[model samples]
Target: MPKKDQGLGPSAETPLPGDDTVVCGVVRHLGGDYLLAKCMDGVDRKVRIPGKLRKRVWINEGDIILVGLWDFSPDKGEVVYKYGRNEINKLIEKGFLSKEFINALSEYL
Candidate 1:
């Protein structure tokens, strides 16, 4: 049997990104090596994980992440941040992330 708290996974306090530099997005699909994300602003963008994050973060479809948009094109971006379960719950409680997103996240968990 699994422990009650064990299902919550590991806890890490990675800081959430500033809205000016990065926006929160939900990973909708994986197009080959790229991630198709729909941002909170209602824009669907193609995102690639930068080399620095590639070695450290593990992203999958339906995960909520932060993406820094490209300067030249509005339709592309880079995944700069990953939100852990604890961080996500905090975001929901703090009103940074919408309640609907949390509902969707619960389906996955």
Candidate 2:
């Protein structure tokens, strides 16, 4: 059978479609103790990248990043692959995200 399309990139600070299996979306909203994000699989999942990610990287909203995949019940997505500041910067420079919103998964390179 042919493989299903992964869909278009996150244009306009949209959540990533959970499919890459390895990649995960960046922080779309951060308020509560944990952060809310749309995973690469397109699943909006909660992540824990506060202490480390926050301090290390200036994680603004809408950042397409690689993340570690974690499973715990029917609802839950944890951050496993945390990119550093430099990497995050590269993502920004790539311009896959919105400059204004600065929140998106990917864009046509």
| Candidate 1 off by > 4 Å | 1-14, 17-19, 22-32, 102-109
Question: Best-fitting candidate, measured by TM-score?
Answer: 1
Question: Which regions in candidate 2 have their CA more than 4 angstroms from the true location?
Answer: 1-21, 81-109
Spell out the clash pairs found in candidate 1: none
lDDT of each: 0.69, 0.50
Please give, for residues 2-108, the per-residue lDDT of candidate 1 as tens digits: 64542223445555657444555555656554777766676778888777676556787767888887888878888877887777788777777787855654554
**What is the Å distance of residue 35 in model 1 from its true position?**
0.3
lDDT of 1 at 25: 55
